[model samples]
Structure formats: structure tokens, C-alpha cells
Target chain A: MKQFLHSGFVRLAIVVVMAYVIVSLCGLREHVSILSGVDESGTMHLVFGLIYILSYAASLVLAPALFLAAIIETTLSKVNVLSRKGQEGRRLGCSELRERQRLRAPEHAP
Target chain B: MKSRLCISAIALILAIAIWLPLLHLFFRPDIGDLGLEKGVSRIADQLAAHHLQIWTNPDLRNRELAQMRQLNPEWDFMSRTFLVMALASIALRDESRIPQCLETIDLVIENTLLIEQEDGFQDFLLGYGYADNWKVQPPKSIFVDGEISLMIGARRMVADRADYQHLMAERIGNMVAQMTLSPVLSAESYPDECWVFCNTIALAAIRLGDVLDHSNHSEFLREWVETAKLHLVEPQSGLLISAYAVDGTPLPNGPGPEGTSIWMACHMLQVVDGAFAQDQYQRAKAQLGRSLLGFGYSREWPRAFAGVMDIDSGPIVPFVEASASASGLALLGAAGFSDKKYLRQLMTSLNIAGFPTRKNGTLCYQASNPVGDAVLLYALVQGPLWEKAK
Candidate 1:
């Protein structure tokens, strides 16, 4: 049932997360040039040159939420009743096949 | 079923740990932007008040100094600088606190000048600095002179009193003339030695020049930094040399993002040139600022530069050169840039490891060098002076 979480929404969520991180980090380069000045107090302030901090910040807020939603979907899908039944069936069938193999094996009583 | 339950439990814990800090990041804090304030930020306020106790109470100050002296004398000098810078900010933030902040500043200015006069300025340096003569016949140390002048200069800039302005003009004139006489745009601080600290001081002096109407000095300050970029600063790290001779010669050192130092350098350069200041801060931030399990840690140097640890870096622990100087100074840089997230992480780290011991209603971080605390104070009280100057 967890496999059901591998759906379109989950994929889209992951892609959004990656894209958000990429663009947010890329935007900081411009800030590098702006902050390199001697301040009035004569002290230097070093920011990572993330002039568009709000944008990286926006991504920082959104990307993780999307990823969390994907994880929840994956978890919820793993808990379905039919999926549980299907797993039970597979476990029983495998057990029975093993028992039959044990019974059918022609071995001298060593 | 049991295995799945255990796995899920572990995953849930990890996820919560990861998301909690990021979650805090979402909520825009309604508080002030971390300038000097009264009771608004208990954290920054407490930090300043603790340093205040040193000047206000001689007994407490002596006890603290006695303990720190066993470590390094540089720390002792740094404590004065940091506290002076912090009080200057506090004065700006709380007008009511001016009388108190000014008292501390006055005492510090007096003591600093007294120390310089008594020790001949070289007393604060490492023994090696005194060894062998500097190549230039008339030895000089712009580093000592520059910072001392700036400290006094900043105090006066915030709340002008007649005493400080006169001293600043004298220091500013001397620094400007020294730059002009040297053809390479480099002044000999110690014989022929040039240092980033001194150069930054000159920049600060020039900035004060602009504020005080020292018009003729601008061109000299501008040209010196340009020539300096060619002679002292490395093209690779974009960080300046740890030390250099007069003629741009590398003295066994290439480049170091030396711990704590890089952050201080960034903060200092912020005074020298805005464009250069911006570049230094961003470079240091990218190279050092890191996050692990949602916690931030800053390194001493970037990958491009390799260096051995020393008194300045202050003990790089394994796997990462977490130079106390660089990381502590990074706090100033991060705060200066207004990178709230990094600042938050750094503050959190300070709270966790900096060993805050609240004594007599004042807050100070234990395990931090005096210089480290000074840098922190400068970070806290930085904005108003800059804004006021403009």
C-alpha cells in the first residue's frame, strides 16, 4: 500500500522542493556585491550576500511542507485495509508453499 | 510489525527535529531587528549588562580579569573593545541608558589610552611580534593604533563629546599622511609590515573622516585599498594575507580563512569599503556557515585555503576547524548582514555551548575569549552608529 504513495502528487511535491532549494540558493549571489560596504559605525556586516533573502526565505518556508505532505501520503497509503489483506495473503501463501515443499522432499531419514 | 513501528518512531523523531527549527523560521518574529534596546531582547540586553558590570564594579572586573589573564592578554584587550562597542549601541538604543553607557565608554577610553601609553602599544601583542626589528626602519603597528582610534572614534560618533573628536582628528591625520607618503599605498605598521587590521583601521578613520569632514583624505583611503587588493589579498580566497611585508611579498603564509578572524575581518572590512565588505561577508558566510541536523556550525577556513591552528584561531577541534575566533566573529558578520536565520542558529549555538552564566543581572558567555565577547558586543550595538553617520 505504501507503493500507492508513489503517485503524481508526491512526485510533483519532490520536484517543487528541489526547484525551490536551487533557485533560492542561486539568488544569494547578488547580495554578495551589495553588503560589502563600510558601514557608518565603521563596522563591516557580512551576510552570505543573500540580498534576496526573502525569496530563499519563501522557499525555506514552502519546500519542506510539500515534502512533509508527500511523506504523510506515503505513510497513510501504507495503512490501507486492502493492502493489509494483500500482505496477509502473501504471507500465508508463502508459508503453505514452504510446508508443501517440506512434506514433498524425498529424503532418507538421516 | 515491531520493526516497522521502531523505524517509524525513529523517523518521526528525526523529522520533528529537522522541522522544528525550520518551523520557527516560518514565524516572522515580531521583536526588534536586534539593535540596541532596553528589555526588548532579554538576550542581547543581558549580554550587554554583564559586560557593564566590569566597569561599574571594580571588584567584579578584577576577578574576571584575573581569571582570564592565565589564558591570553589579547583577550583582556578585546574585552574592552567589545564592551565599548556594545555600550555605544546600548546608548543609541536607550537614551536613558546613555549616562550609564557613556560612563563605561569613558572609563574604557581612558584605560585603553592609559594602557597604550604604559605598555607602548606592543605589550598587547604576542612575543614574536616584538622579536627582530620590522623591515621598515621606523617600526609601526597600524593595527593597534587603528582599532584604538576607532573605538574612541565610535564612542564620540554616537554621542559627541569634545574630547574624542580631537583625538580622532589627530589619529585620522596621522593615518592618512602615512598612507600618502608610502608610494605603494601601504603604510609600514611594524617597520615594513602591513596588516589587514591596520588597513581596516585606516578605512574606519577615513569613514570618520567623511563624517567629520576630512575631505582631502578620501582619495588616499580609496587608492590604498585598491593597491592593497593587488599586494595583500589573495585572488583565490579573496581573503587578505595574515601578514605581509611592504612590497606584497608572501611571508610563508598564502591565505587563511583563519577561524574567528575571517568573521572579524568581514565585520572590519564592512567599515573600509562597502563593495569589498559585501564580498568578504558573503564569501565567509558561504565558506563557513553550515547546518547539521538543523543546527548551524561555522568553519574557520574555506576549502581553498589550508592553515595550521594558532593563538588567533583558538583551538580548531577535529573534522572541522571551528576556530573560536572565526565562529564568534561570524556572529557579528551574520548579525551585520541581517541574516536572521543564521543569526538565530548562531545564537542557539552560543546558548548551547557558550556557557552563559548570568551573574548579578548581567549576562556573559563563558568559554568565549574576551575578544570573542567584544566582537559579540560590536554585533549587538552596530546598526545605530552606521545609520546615524549616514
Candidate 2:
């Protein structure tokens, strides 16, 4: 499950799905309120309902794109090149910087 | 558990995709039954739901007004014009609310005329006003004259304060004379050039004149049509041009509905000439109006032409082809001719997207201009004023 979550493809799909849920719920909540007579058009429930449905339908068309985004995000991270390239540049670390400074300070003190 | 979670997630997403648009259906107003009754209409109720904010709150009104003016000052001006006219029509529609509506309308008119007379009509000009002479002489605009005249007429039609009647007459007379003296029954906002839209402005004046019994002005109205046939009519669309040279000569291009002028033209035509008004309304409807999923909106241009967004169309929405200017002015067409079908859809479109608020018996649309809402209000109450006056 953790591995699945870490997969970029699943991550992308999740993001899309999450957005879809949030917007739909927000729109639905507004519709529910209006339907309950929080607005002037006490009977305009039908109109708001259609708008919500159309928006929901439009969101579904993005499913394939979500799948593709997931694949790409995962694929882009795993491409590999040689260990030889790693030796071409000096690998520095916090300990290496401290060691070099200590050596220089002691030599200067002597 | 994972499968159930996945299933629910998919279901939830699908549910939203299907439902948000359905919300529009819920707000869809009945087209036939929304008749502007002796009391406030469901449509007026929808409009006022938004408009009440303008009167009740200063900061909110100014902020919204500023945002629209950033795009089109004419909107700022037309918003007032439309709201004042709408309130007047509402007064006639509902005698009980006349006092409250009157106070708001009076405030709007007071602000409008004061600004125009104080800053000169040039105050409403786009940044382009000083960039080039958009008009002839020092600087004059027939569009401003016509709107102000209608605003004054609308005010007087309701309240009958002594001064507005005279103001209406004087303004109407100037527009009539302006139409007469132009070589082709058209007046210019620029040097000797004429616009069908401006002619429509003049038509509004002519209609006001009709109410006032300037039967003599019939010839003026006739000449305007004949001249438009000769010069302004686009061969392909048969729709009028956005502008032209004064003497029956077509300008280089065809009509553009991205401004207040064209919609106002359609409305003014209804008042000045009945058949012509009907023709204009149908042409405009074909060119711009659309209904989808029971909601109605209008495009800034017909399919035959493509144009960019401007001050009038206000932040064009994609795919559905709705323009702020076209949709707002569309109220005139829907109301002027009593096209119940269009009015029904127009109301639905407005309620869903125009963000209406109703408070303490006043209505307003937040995303709409004062003028645009007023036009909607006018649409609701239009019939008798034109009828009683005629």
C-alpha cells in the first residue's frame, strides 16, 4: 500500500480524483443549501442541479489524462546513467568540510 | 478495503462530474410564467437578489463598479441607466414598492447626470479618448446623449418630477435633430462618420419622441432605415455594421457586438420601428444567442465573424460563446418583443452564473453591471411604459 502511494502514477491520479471530489462536494453543498431555501428563487433547484451534473460529467473526461500523468511522473524519475559520472565530480559532505578545516588549522598552528 | 476506497473515489469524482452542471437545471426559471406581474416577478426577484447590494452597501457597490469600469466605463454608465430604467418599470409593475425603488433610481440618476455634467461626457471615454479623437469637433458622443435621454425619460415616466420631463424632451430633441442633419440619417461619434449602433441610440430617442407625440419625427425614423439599407447592412449577414461614414457609405468592416452600442441598437429599434425592431432582434438572436442545457447566453459575435474580447463583451467565457455585453443587453430583446422563451433562458443563465443576491426586497447581480441588471429589470417591466406612452 505504501509502495502504491509512493508511485507517481498513482499520486497523479489521486490528485485528480481528490480535486474532483472537492469541487463536486462544494458545488453540491451549494445546491443543497439553495434547494433548502437559503436563496430568493425558492424553486430554482432544477437549474442548479443541471449545472452541477454537467460539471461532474466534464470532470470524468479527465480520467485518461490522470492515468497518463501518473505514468509520466513515475517514469521520469527512474532513468539511470553510469557510476563513472559520479567520480567526475568531487563528492563533498559536512564531515569532509569539517575535516579539511581541522587539518588546515592544525598545520597553521604548528 | 483498498478496492472499496478506490471504488468510492471514482464514484465520488463521477458523481461530481455529473451533478455540478445539473445545478444549472435546478435554477432554470420557467420561461412562460415569469410574466412581469403587478408584483415583482420571479425574474425580477432573481435580478434584485443581486441588485439590492448596490443600494444597501457603498463599498461593495463601488468595488464591483470599479472592476467593471476597469473593463468598460460605458458599463459603469449603462449599469446606472439600466438600473434606473428597471426601477422605473418595477415601480409601474408594483405600486407598493415604488417608493423604495424610486429612492434607489433617484440616487443612480443623480450620480450619473452629476458625473456627466461635471466631468463632461468625456469622463466615460476609454483610455483611447485622448489617444485620438473618437468623435468630431472638440469631443462629442451621440451614445452618451441617447443613454442619458433614456435614463431621464425612464425617471420621469415613473415619478413625473417636473425637471426630468423637460430634460427628456430636450435630450430627445437633440438626438432627433442630430439624426436629421446627418447626411444619411445617422450621427457620428467621430468626424462625420455614423454607426448603426448610434442610429439605434437615436432610435431610442425617436421612440421616446413617439411617446411624446413627435409624429413629425416619423420621416426621420424612415430615413434612418433607408440609409442603413444603403450603407450599413453587411452583405453576408444582413446585420448592420458597427459603424460607417455618414453619407450611406459602408465602413471597412461589419457589425461587432462587443460594445453597448449594438445591443442598445436592437432595443432602440424596437421602440422606434416595430417591424425593424423585430428583424433586428431575430438577426441578433441568430448571430449571438444560444441555449444549452436549458440555460441561455449570447456570443459577442456571430459564427461568421471572430473577434477578441473588449470592454463590452467583458471577460468572455470559453466554448459556450457568451459575452457579458451581449448577454446583458439581450434583456432588451427578450423583453422588448416579449420573447418569453428567450427571457426564460436568459434568467436561468443569469441566476446560475451572474451571482444574484436578494435582500430586503431589492435585487442585484454581482457579476453584472448596474446597467445590465437594469436592462433585465426593464425587460421585466417594459410592456406598459412603451404601450401607455405610445
TM-score of each: 0.71, 0.69
lDDT of 1 by residue, B1-390 (tens): 675555445544554556656654433323353543433266667777777766778897776665554455556766776677777777777788888888889898898789788977666655555756765444556766676777786787667777777787787777766666555555555556665655665676567657755455556657766876776666676776655666656545424445465566666666566787788777777777875544456876677777766655656758755655666777788877777777766666555445455666776654564456667767766767656543
Q: List candidate 1 stretches off by more than 4 Å.
A: A1-110, B1-33, B36-40, B180-184, B187-192, B213-215
DockQ of each candidate, alpha-carbon based: 0.04, 0.02
Among these predicted structures, which one has the highest TM-score? Answer: 1
lDDT of each: 0.63, 0.64
Provide all candidates' interface root-mean-square deviations: 12.8, 13.6
- Candidate 2 local lDDT, residue A71: 43
- In candidate 1 the C-alpha lDDT for residue B227 amounts to 78
Candidate 1's DockQ: 0.04
Error of 1 at B356 (Å): 2.0
